[model samples]
Target: MGRYRETYERWKASPEAFWAEAAREIDWSKPWDRVLTLEGDLSRWFEGATCNTCWNALDRHVEGGRGEQLALIHDSAMTGKVKRFTYRELRDKVATFAGVLQRHGIGKGDRVILYMPMVPQAVVAMLACARLGAIHSVVFGGFAAKELATRIDDARPKLIVSASCGLEPGRAIAYKPLLDQAIELSEHKPEACIIVQRAELEAPLVPGRDFDWKDEMEKARAAGAAPACVPVAATDPLYVLYTSGTTGKPKGVVRDNGGHMVALKWSMKNVYGVDPGDVFWAASDVGWVVGHSYIVYGPLLHGCTTILFEGKPVGTPDAGTYWRVIADHGVKALFTAPTAFRAIKKEDPAAELVKKYDLSKFELLFLAGERGDPDTIQWAERALGVPVIDHWWQTESGWPMVANPMGLERLPVKYGSPTVAMPGYEIQVVDEAAKPVPANTTGAIVVKLPLPPGCLPTLWHNDEGFRNSYLADYPGYYKTADAGYLDEDGYLYVMSRTDDIINVAGHRLSTGGMEEVLAGHPDVAECAVIGVADALKGQVPVGFLVVNKGVNRPAEEIAKEAVALVRDKIGPVAAFKTALVVQRLPKTRSGKILRGTMRKIADGEAWSMPATIDDPVILEEIGEALSDAGYGRKG
Candidate 1:
């Protein structure tokens, strides 16, 4: 048997022993009395242990003689700036910043919200918070004031760290006004604010309430006030990441320090197949879970050089920017959302710009955040001549639940599937009644509880809410909210979110399955399949196709081909007769298609604007397209 199977079986047989061994990789100030403990439906790993996440990420590495090694590389295509920090340099900066926070009365268990751009200061601030054993919440930079206000009220942070401005391709977005507005709107006001003044646009700061980031750091340095790491309990909350909830309120998913460090550190070597000192880059913002796990903590905890990229996949200069970064940095692995590659594919269909850079050092490419259509994965595989692996996880999981374990063994690539469950996750496909479904039968995907190390233990300050949102769905499992089937070989196929399963004349169909067929079209660069209201069939699928940049065929012709493809692949039961060719699909800043909002628009229901929308104008374009196709509210 291969190592992956053996390791999985060992974990299955003795989960406690398996995790106890993994826990040893992390440096603990106090040893755990028990490796695993369960209370009601909640599971806590490494209970009774004490550790500091920042120490494991930075100080330990510095002390271990990797001090001069490159720890972080911040490359900003928006500002045309590049900055590097070694392990020692990063640790010193984080310690000094920790001192600054300490002076502001921030201590263990205190909450600090970081709303900054993809700059090194943002990373330093996060590590500094961890160094002081404080819980940090990072909201996406430039978030709407109302949304930011909601987060502020929920987290009740003592202080906020923000930047003056955030850079885009052609312009700079002033973040200070938004932060000020959020503070004005929130019921619970923070005591102080620290603003980073970027050269692109310096924001006006309020005296006595706001402090300059540079000034505080300089003061801390002048006083030689570098604080040592503060150890906290293993179950102490490390960070609270807020994900959109069904109740229209955000759910703050809480991650603990010890389990987070162990699982992520192990994943860097065993899952990503990257050794210490290798350059790793996750092209995502720190506000998201991927950024929290991989960009800041995971790579650093594993002693690897992590890259912080502040640019789009295609727009910063051209489609060649990703390749250029990878070739220049000798990045061994690149993890990003599939939407990024689709954007690049739309602009450069033939990937001719790939020839301009040397990507021989780029070993693997990982895609997540949504279902990676087989067509896109295959295209990336052929274009890059590397393994384009699709992994599946969520903001709550904090790490990959289903993935191809490249380090243990290179499993055969399976299109439309993330491959198999990881060591800690026991994935199962079950029906609404919580009974296991037959293999290859579509059902809800869930993980058998207690969830492995690194997964969210509870919602911040809302234990009942956590139980209702996750545990109540399936009594003995953690509801993934995703729909898919397990193959005969045990490979997990994450078809789509459970809500995307549309019922057409009593037959449930996965929109993702139809989307896969549509994405396979030669001219289709990107696509989204949403189920719209249908009086006759209850619900029907609608395909929105964005063709390649050079495609000159009539939109109607391409639409007809897409309809035919879905009909051929999924049959008439799909009720997918209508397809529209649109310029682009509306997506969030993190590249998630706003399907729920789109559905509301198509059905002509009362729907408010999404706060995280990348471009609100795209929704207007979509409504017009729907109206043109004799759907939605008609004049």
Candidate 2:
């Protein structure tokens, strides 16, 4: 048997012992009373322990004689600037920042909201919060004021850290206006705001409430202020990440201190196969969970050099920017969303830009945050000539639930699957009645409770909401809300969200399956399939395709071919007939296709503009395309 199966079986035998062994990698101020404990349905790992995440991530490395080693590399393609910080440098910065926050009466358990762009200060602020045992919630930079206000009210931060402006390809988005608006709109007003004034755009600060970030840091440094790391209990709240709830109010997924550090540090070597000192880059924004885990904590805790990239896959100059960053930094592994690769593939179909840089040191490419379509995965594999592993997890999980553990074993690649379940997750596919389904049969995917370490203990301030959201659906399992199945060999194929499964005349079909077929089309760059209301078949699948940049063939012809491909591959049971060629698909800032919104548009149902949409104009374009295809509202 492979090492993966052996390790998984061992973990299954005794989860507490497995986690205890993993805990050894972390530095703790006080040992735990127990490895695991259960209170009703909620499980807590490493209870009664005390540890400071900032100490392990920064100070530990510095004290271990790796002070000169590079800790963070902030590379911004938009600004054409690069900043590097050694372990010692970063540690000192974090310590001083912690002192700054301390001076502002921020301490353990106090909440701080970070509303900054992909800047080095954002990283420092997060570590600073951890150093003081404070809980930090990072709202995505440049979010709509109303959405930011909602989070501000929910998290109720004592202090807010923000940048003056966030840069796009050719423009600068002034965040001060939005931050000011959110604060004005919020009922729970924060005491202070620290605004990072960027060179691109310097925002006017409020007279009393807003303080200049640079001035505060300088004052703290001049005073030789450095705060010592504060020890907190294992189960103390580390961070609260908000994921959109069905009820419109966002759910704050709470991650704990000890378990989070242990799981993420373990994942660095075990999941990505990267050693200490190796440069690892997660091309994601810190506003998202991937950023919170990999870009900041994971790499730092593992003593790997992490990159903070502030650019797009295609427009940050060119599609060659990613290759350039890898070649220049000698990045050993890169973890990014599949949508990024799709964007790159769309612009550079032949992967010609890849040849411009030397990526010999780049060994592994991990894709998450979206279903990694087989076509995109295959294209990435061919382009990068490295293992393109697509892992599966969620904002609540904080770490990967299912992945190909490259460090433990290099398992055989499966095109659509994210390989097998990790040691901690006992994934099972079950039908609506909660009965286990046969292998390869599509159903709701769930994890047998209690969930392992690093996953959300509960939603912040809402234990009942947590139970209702995840646990109530499955009696003894954590409802993943994802629909997929495991193969006979135990490899998981995460096809789509549970709601994405469409029913056609009593037959349930996966829209992700249809999307996979459409993506496989030779000229298609990216695609999305959503089920629209149809009187004839209950619900029929409609596809939207974004063809490759250079493909000049008639859009109608290509759309017809895509429809045929889906009909042939998924069989006529899909009822997949219509495919519209569009310039782009509407996506959130995090690159998730807004299928629900598109479905609403096609069904002629009243739908509000999504707050997280990357561009509002894209939805208008999509609506027009649907109308031309005889789908959307006649008006």
Candidate 3:
């Protein structure tokens, strides 16, 4: 009867009903005849449809009385200032940028690489590309020059977008320096780069090849031509996101328009419970699918005010940066990773930063990225007096599957469920054979039918790569490769990744379970527990840690307490093979620690394996600490 019920019914009535209905809410020059068509192994939603996602998300919102209302709130971490952009203002900016692309022969289906910080304009540029019907590939802002260049070469985008200066944890890095390097690597770099000037850093403008973003916008406006309407089908490519390749080269995962729009718009309303006036902050960089969905397209299409803050969550002056922005903006919903929760919990728990901000304004606190430790969620809820939601999804599936329900959070968290496959998604916990697993039994988490938005259609340039990585592993079902068990209530509790599980004497334990134990300790700030090769136990868990900044305890003592904490939390079998406290954990830019690298460190090898780690130094730290502990002598 209401928005939630109607939305649920609309989805349940038919597999493709929800997206078909949502499509009507947007502007369409031409609409599809059928909702979905399944032929052979392929499924298409809104087949033969024609519409512009950017027009629905931005331009139409400006025309629909919500134009003057703020749609994006920029909370600058480096400057400690907040900037607001209204729907109308956003539309104009996007139109201007789209115009810039038009001037450079950029049109429908062209690839554009947005390698910039989490500033407001970054989102603006992304939407602008969408408006022009171009496929965007946003490289993680923290990626070194080499990583950025790799993606640039992969997509072969015609343009590379960067800020004159961008925010980093401790200080601003000269972004153009990296942009220059990426340009050198880009096979299809534009004749001129568009710089979203920020940080007030001195312009290291590459002579004759870079253009001021603001000035270019003025030029586009002065020409005053009608916005170009590039002909594109509804199912046209929207983005190509690159996930870290477990093998050598990263794979570019491509997502189509119709599915992305429907899945994200619906998830935003039902999952985050995003409302018209709500200020949402998906504290993820634009590089990942999370940013593509919640941060950019989803929130905008829902007609909500969202935050686009640039800088690290922990050290933007202090650990309180996230809290301060929420209070200042009265952000109603927040989505971040467990990595941040565990990492920040290492800071002064009762510091004045806690007392300085009022988090009561936020209605929902959501967790994704990695397993949401029940321990972390509970502490955050208690400290902030708000229910914390933990959701689970992947780069491949595109949209959230398991999560705290956006429109139904009051139902009470089931502690580890991703909230029952989300409404339109068909999620299941299955065995190695891809058959459904019984309740309370751990197995692979898989999606059944009708892939949701934010889900990649295929690997950017490789079709079989997508099928092999996601579809081929478990035929007929998109195997997530994450292990989990569904509770009696159908709540899915994701264990760590399949490789992240530990089997010792027939007892299987998740890294999350061990992490929950390590985090429960009062002295422990943050830790990583990885299963390592052990001839006796088959495989055992080892703890690598970063203690609180000023803790006077010696490394050996911290390691001792860490093991005791793990033992107490689970059982004696949870003991570490070798516990080492390090200066920092090696993590991807997204805050996911490189556990595979940790596993290598425990094997007493040189840790020279370049398989999973972005940085090789974290392995070195583990090696030095292990050497000092005399673990080798004990062997």
Candidate 4:
């Protein structure tokens, strides 16, 4: 703890010097004229610098005589395939693809969208764009054509790279057909499309706009075409990643070149505690931010081996898939979402399969992408016998804002909190008027002016949207839109979204807090809480729960126990009265609970269905359950 305080003091004293020193670790083409500059709400680091992100990720290591080092390890349980690529091989492939893109008239500042699966080609596409200074936007592979059409119309890419099909546990999803339909539906179409034929899935090819990906690469290699790295300005755009908006249309978060490179490289050693040649695995898809930072750029920049696993946590083979991967690859650091653990715990509560593997090499496990409830955290810690660190960040911030720094000093684990803010982030809890509140008070989370290096600079083509969404409410702070409080020791306890707070009889209550207590019940597998309209109180807490399978317990009995557990843990002020057993809770594909949607459905209000919903049928089930409970008026 003292070590944490010491590091914080050094950073708070002189942040510009602190970050400038961190930037020295990267390989720069030319030095910057200024270390840091701020204008109103925007920040620029390493102004006037020229650097190529692809060169730092690939060429630098190969030039340093570490070309033989392993750079990528891809293993897919669905296809039973294993592939490895060294730094030298990766650089050559990137150069070849860069040449191919150039031949199609895609040059610097041109937009190219990549809609491929979790294969090695996705990484190559991203690096190829970075090599030529082009901007690449990758959409998740499983999205429908209507969803893909909106992105195509927004980005207006000159070219698109996609695969023929994607393989899941029990089926093969056709991607080329999806792309075709999306192109037909979109108003703005790309000039050409490149397709990787994986399983002979036939797709209609337009007369002069579609080509085979492998054939183009072969032709480029045969002609001895190799594209050199193009130097980009420090403030140039690196990539635009759209958020998985559960309630609205997605926003493109734009990340810059030099700052993103420097911040990710520094965080690899300082936050994750891994170095060159270490094995790091983040169990997420390439479409997400974690995959962008950890799986692709961060590990490669550090010359480490990153595992890209194409399998689900529970179904790929069995409940032991994650354990098997860790043992097989000797993974040193593992990162995933807490919802995964909840699923595994539901299937195997006693952890019988986990005991079968040898996990001596596993060092740490990280949980992100949602709030980590205390019950889930304790279960993971006890089951794996390792520290489960819950870090917090957003898509806007490329990397972690608050984490327990394993490299600096490991702090004592707090069951329900993401530890202190990382260096270079000034976090504060404030009321509605933008005034600071005392410790142990719940309020909106805000970050002071001059956000650190890796944070988003602005929205793509929508600078006004960026200002109104993040900076308008707080004069000099970036509003996180999350409701949380800071403890006496400076630990952060993220309660829920601000709208998720329930105003019960003029007292505020966090549904996250109530859900955590309900999850402690012996027979409860999963639970979701929402604030429903009540005549007596302004709002009241209602819980929807899923009991463990094969538990041989009555639904009514389990609900009574859950209510009793909440009453015993949290006092009467919580206003937690009712618990209804349900089949499942509605969630997005990324595994976030749809509490707002649930609340609307329970209150009999019309709501727009979110685009990212995992299963729409679950919404009907929830509505029926609510109707059976006598809250059935539909408006």
| Candidate 1 whole-model C-alpha lDDT, 0 to 1 | 0.94
User: Where does candidate 4 stray beyond 4 Å?
Assistant: 200-202, 246-250, 632-635
Instruction: Report the lDDT tens digits of candidate 3 across residue range 1-635.
Output: 24445555567777666677766655676878887777554566777888778887887777778999898888777777878889988888888888988887778888888877778778878888888889988877656677777787778887777787766656666878877876687565666678877746756677777788888888898997337445468678888888864344568877888767777777777778777778888898788788888888888888888888776667777888888888898889989998887766767554446678887787888889877776677778777777788888887777777666657544557665656666666678887777887898888888875565456667877777767777887778777788878888767888778999888867788887777777666666677788877788888887777777568878888778778777766878765545777888887767788777667666665444443354667666766765675432111
Worst 10 residues of 4 by lDDT: 243-252
For model 1, the superposed segments whose C-alpha errors exceed 4 Å read: 245-248
Each model's TM-score? 0.99, 0.99, 0.92, 0.97
How does residue 97 of candidate 4 score in lDDT?
A: 95
In candidate 3, where is summed lDDT lowest over 10 consecutive residues? Answer: 626-635
The pairs that clash in candidate 4 are: none
Q: Local error of candidate 1 at 533, Å? A: 1.4
Estimate the TM-score for candidate 1.
Answer: 0.99
Off by over 4 Å in 2: 245-247
Tens digits of per-residue lDDT for model 4 on 571-633? Answer: 888877789999888988778899988898888888877767778999889888888887745
Residue-level lDDT tens digits of model 1 in 1-635:
29999999999999999989988888999999898999999999999999999999999999999999999999999988899999999999999999999999999999999999999999999999999999999999999999999999999999999999999889999999999999999999999999999998999999999999999999988988889999999999999988952234679999999999999998998899999999999999999999999999999999999999999999889998999999988999999999999999999999899989999899999999978999899889888999998999999999999999998988998899999999999999999999999999999999999999999999999999999999998999999999999999999988889999999999989989999999999999999989999888999999999999999999999999999999998898898899999999999999999998888889999888888888999999999988988778742
Model 2 Cα displacement at 34 (Å)?
A: 1.0
Residue 558, candidate 1: C-alpha displacement in angstroms: 0.5
RMSD (CA, Å), each prediction: 1.0, 0.9, 3.1, 1.7
